[model samples]
Target chain A: MLRIPCPYCGVRDQSEFDYGGDATVNYPALDASEQEWFEAVYLRDDPKGPHTELWRHARGCRMWIIVERNTVTHEITGARPANPAHAEVLKRDFELETT
Target chain B: MGRYSAWEIIKQGLTGNKGWERAWRDPEPKARYDAIVVGGGGHGLATAYYLAKEHGIRNVAVLEKGWLGGGNAGRNTTIVRSNYMIPGNTEFYEFSLKIWENLSQDLNYNVMMSQRGQIVLFHSPAGRDAAARRLNIMRLNGIDGELLDREQVMKMVPHLDYSENARFHILGAAYQPRAGTARHDAVNWGFARAADQLGVDIIQNCEVTGFLHDATGAAIGVQTTRGEIRAGKIGVAVAGHSNRVAQMAGVGRLPIEAHALQAFVSEAVKPHLDYVIAFGGIGHFYISQSDKGGMVYGGDLDMYNNYAQRGMLPVVHDVHECVMQVMPSLGRARLLRSWGGIMDMSMDGSPIIDKSPVEGLYLNCGWCYGGFKATPASGFCFAHLIAKDEPHPAGAGLRLDRFRHGAMIDEKGAGATAWHH
Candidate 1:
């Protein structure tokens, strides 16, 4: 079983969290085109290596956390809040370091 | 390939079984061919066979990165069914069922296709109504499907938990009498041998690294680990690696994700389970007793996009919980082994058998968890498209651009999410 680290509630069992899919998506404006919205909703990347995904602490503190994990190895590299303030900083740092 | 018959078996018995030849030959990769299949699994081998037998294209090569049937072809739970409700899928799967009916004779090999039947249990009124609608659609399509009431389900599978206080109490089920399991490895071997006999080269341990395109940007060949080989046409049936292979040909992202789907088997015991049974309640658990008496079963995907051919323990626990809830007696059966296959979950939960944007390049992928059952029709239709440059009637609706045009064939009505399907 995976032990995911929730930013608000420390590390916990994977069953306590509900998967929320890719965390890299940026929702378009309310008046964005249908194509843009469709791409944003449906055209998500499925990379083979490390990925950042959203996981909700359903059975715990009820906070959305961005968990940086490896899809192939299932390794937890980092975790932080999915709140915009912290999420943007983490994502940018991840992209910069990886690139 | 030598003809396999009872007479041959008797003759071999008399000769101490020494006259048997190898099922297929391990041939060296040629420098060029009329057509090349980029995966030596069941679909690619069958595509090569039909391309030679029906399309009169004898010079074909099937390149595999590993040994034949080493991928998802031999990794699935092996349950075969045609109980789909959608228009395109129902006809296509029914056509596959028909092909499977005579597959052994057609390929001159015993595929061991069993038709014990399949029962999908529904636990609630809403579930029953939805199953009724799906069954009506099946009946309309001339495919067999019967709605079984509580007593009928109890009669069919008496071992199931039927107590009034049981979790997810049994309400009814949809039964498909012609649905069953097949010997997955035998299917792959049979197709490879038949295709080899029809003058197709079956090259193993050869991986395609890149594509060869002409000035017009049409794919004409591939660069493999062995070497570069030219072909008139190239068909990619690389299952979970569909997006990876497509990238080599300059075809970017696809509406597909590779997720690990795990299956478990219990230790062999006295025969008890006679039919393939699936739960339609909260969790996605399906179980069937193998011919060897082992209970082969599986549940939902691991709910992550990973190309690794392995899954997590959470899904394993989820499956065990569901199985124990349905059949309490199975709680005593110890699990012997567990394995996972990379499923190419498409956005619409249906397959994509169409021509790639690059000319002369054909694709047969996005099979999700249903590829094993659709092997025959997937090959037949893909070969037709590669040969004629047009979609086969059975696969006409499975276009790659469906997502862009909002023509998605979402069978489970799960919208566009890959893992939900």
Candidate 2:
């Protein structure tokens, strides 16, 4: 099982989380063209190497996080909170714990 | 090899079994062909066979990166069923069922197609009602279906949990006596040998690197590891690595995500489970005893986008949990082997056997985890599409733009979640 290091809940088994899908997608405007909406929502590059994706700690802290992982080897390298403020808080906590 | 028959088998046994030639030739890749099919798995080989047999396009070549049946062909649990309810999916799968009925005879090979039957257990009355609705539709479509009560189900499958205090008590089941399993490897080689007999080339170790397109923006050929090969038409049936091949062909992003689905086979046991069974509650799990006595089974996908032909440990727990939940008697059965197959999950939980945007580039992908059972019809319909340049009636609904058109065949309403189905 994958040991995802959630920024809030630390490392946890993958069963404790849920997949959220491609984090690299940039949703078009609410009034965007139908084609744009279709492309953004349905189409996927589905690369063979490292890509940023989303995962939710559904059973842990229930926080959505961005994860950097490889699709080929499934090697997780880093992760951070989805929200900028939460990421700042996580960085501060790491610095304080180290000091 | 000559015609395979009971007489030939007995004669071969007497003649020291030296009469049989190679099942298929390992011919080198030709410089050109009338049509080229990528991926020599069950679907690809079947497509090549139909192209030669049905369409009379004998100048065909099937290119395989590895040996035949090396991919999902040998990885699946070999469960074949056509219990779909959706309109677009129902006809296509039933057509596949029709093909499976006569596959062994049609191919002149003993595919070992077994019609032992399959049952989907329902735990609650409401679940039974839902299953009843689906069975009603199947009957309406002229397909065989039966709604068995708890008593009948217990008599048929006595090992299921029937106690009143059971966590998920068995109420009844929806069964299709025609649904069963087939030998996966035989399906591949049978199609390969049959296609070869019809004068189609079965080329292995020929990896397609890129597509060669004309200035008019039509695909003319492919650049492969064996060298450049030309073709009047190109069809791709590489299910797992379809998106990668599409990228190399410059088809842009497909509505597919690669995910690994794990399957397991336990050590041989006594022949008890005659019918394939699906767990009704909780996680996705199904099991059926193979002819060799091993219990072939599997659960849901690993719930992530992955190209690795391996799975995580959590699904091991998830599958075993359901196994013990439904059949607690086999708690001590040791797992013999486990493996994974990368599935090309589309936006909708269906397949896409249609023409690509580019001319001469036919796309036969998006079979998802259900491709194993759809092998026969998928190849036939794909062959039709490639030859006629129009979607076959049975496969007309499996278009690439169905999601954009808001016409998804989303059974169980899993929506866009890749792993949910």
Candidate 3:
């Protein structure tokens, strides 16, 4: 089972969470064309390195979270609520761990 | 209820001789086979039969430790869909869908292949986006997948819980017109008969004890519970027991998890479910009513990893509750039976069909719960690999080395939830 680290509820089984795709996907501007909209949603780098993705704790307290995971080993190096400060802390932790 | 003795069903249906023995109780394995296929499930028998019929490789033996198809093949909820996102997987599964289209005619057996259509419901905007992207990709790959609107989805199944307060109100669904279900047993029996007719020995009770390696450290034969069977080529079609079998060949650990996936059947009713109902938000619960009027349904893999065939009470309770929530009419229906099967969930939640690092030992497994759907194509592709000593174009990326080479074809982006396939 996918072990998702719920930012609010701590680590839990993936059965409790719904996977949101790449975390960097921002809603396009109101006048965006179909091509740009498609690129924003459909196109992804999907690199084989560290990736920041979104996950929702559906079965628990419904909250979207950012999970920094390794595509190779499937290890969650860091995770936090989809908040700026939380993301900053995660980024710092990741940097410290990598270095 | 879905509880009927196999004897009662087969008593007057059809039969001259009760074909295919339960070989687990018998002894004596034959030596010198033209082809020795491991894992005597539907795929193994189908491959053996196809080899004799299509390629004329007649001297074959299907080695099985237990009753044929008693593994994941028998335990799967019998869903067949070729609606894939990736080009390679989509193309390969389309070929399998073709075989499924004419399978009953080709096998001359009643597989009960019902193209009743399968609807995958999306509850959230993210889910809808994913479904739309998948539909677009499927269309690009020449597959008939459509994004159905709320009205269309309601028209297909009116009894679904569409009220706004429900979990994530059903946004819409991705429907595949051709995707359907089949009788799992018929698939196994059909292949077994065909293989038996074409001089392929069905060796049951023959557990592979160890791999017999040549002087150059290549697999030349396998020592079985009965005896040693030497063959020019060997195919491991085992699914859940993939890691154990791979170890016998001195292969590295597979990036696969063994998880128990459970399925339940409800009491017979005046068939309420017309098509397969799969919820993307509701724990991957896919339910379809069988021809017998029993609700044959399944939920996600059990949270823990174990080989236990029995399921926990909470999982069954959750499934029953979820099924009730999906179709309120099924609330009073009694769950007649529930069972679990070990799934060989690959790291990418896709199958692996590769010539292993060990020479002469080929793999055709990691199918998770998709063995029944890919039976014909798996046999076709795996036979090609074993016969030609190379990967078929369809199964090229399925190589075991793809993990090391950084080329993974994850059908579902369950890369993190990979273990739950």
Who wins the TM-score comparison?
2
Ranking by TM-score: 2, 1, 3
Give the C-alpha miss distance for residue B169 in model 2, angstroms. 0.6
All candidates in order of lDDT, best leading:
2, 1, 3
> Candidates 1 and 3: which is better by DockQ?
1
**Model-by-model lDDT, in order?**
0.89, 0.89, 0.77
Q: Positional deviation of B348 in candidate 2, in angstroms?
A: 1.1
Candidate 2 wrongly placed segments (more than 4 Å): A83-99, B414-421
How displaced is residue B335 in candidate 2, in Å?
Answer: 0.4
| Span of 10 residues, lowest total lDDT, candidate 2 chain B | B412-421
| TM-scores, each model vs. reference | 0.94, 0.96, 0.77
Local accuracy of candidate 2 as per-residue lDDT tens digits, A1-99: 888999887899888999988888877989999999888888888989998998988898767799999998888999987755545665576532211
Better of 1 and 3 by lDDT: 1
lDDT (tens digit, per residue) of candidate 3 on B1-421? 1212467458535775355343222335677887899989988888888778877898888999998878877898989998888755887887788898998878766789999999999988888899999999988878898899888999989989988767658879999999999999989987887677677888887899889889988888899888888998888888877876887688656666566789989888896888988987656688999999999998876644345566655577678777867887788888888888877766666788878888888888778767779999889888888887777787666667555444677777664443233
lDDT per residue (tens digit) for residues B1-421 in model 2: 6979999999999999988899888888889999999999999999999999999999999999988888999889998889889988998999999999999999999888999999999988888998899999998988889999999999999987788767888889999999999999999989999999999999998899999999988999999999999999999999999999998897877989888999999999999798999876556889999999999999998878899988899999989988888888788999999999999898777899988888899999988879989999999999999999988898898988887888888977655643343
Where's the lowest-lDDT run of ten residues in candidate 3 chain B?
B19-28
RMSD of each: 3.9, 3.2, 9.8
Off by over 4 Å in 3: A1-99, B1-28, B414-421
State how far residue A44 of model 3 sits from its true place (Å): 29
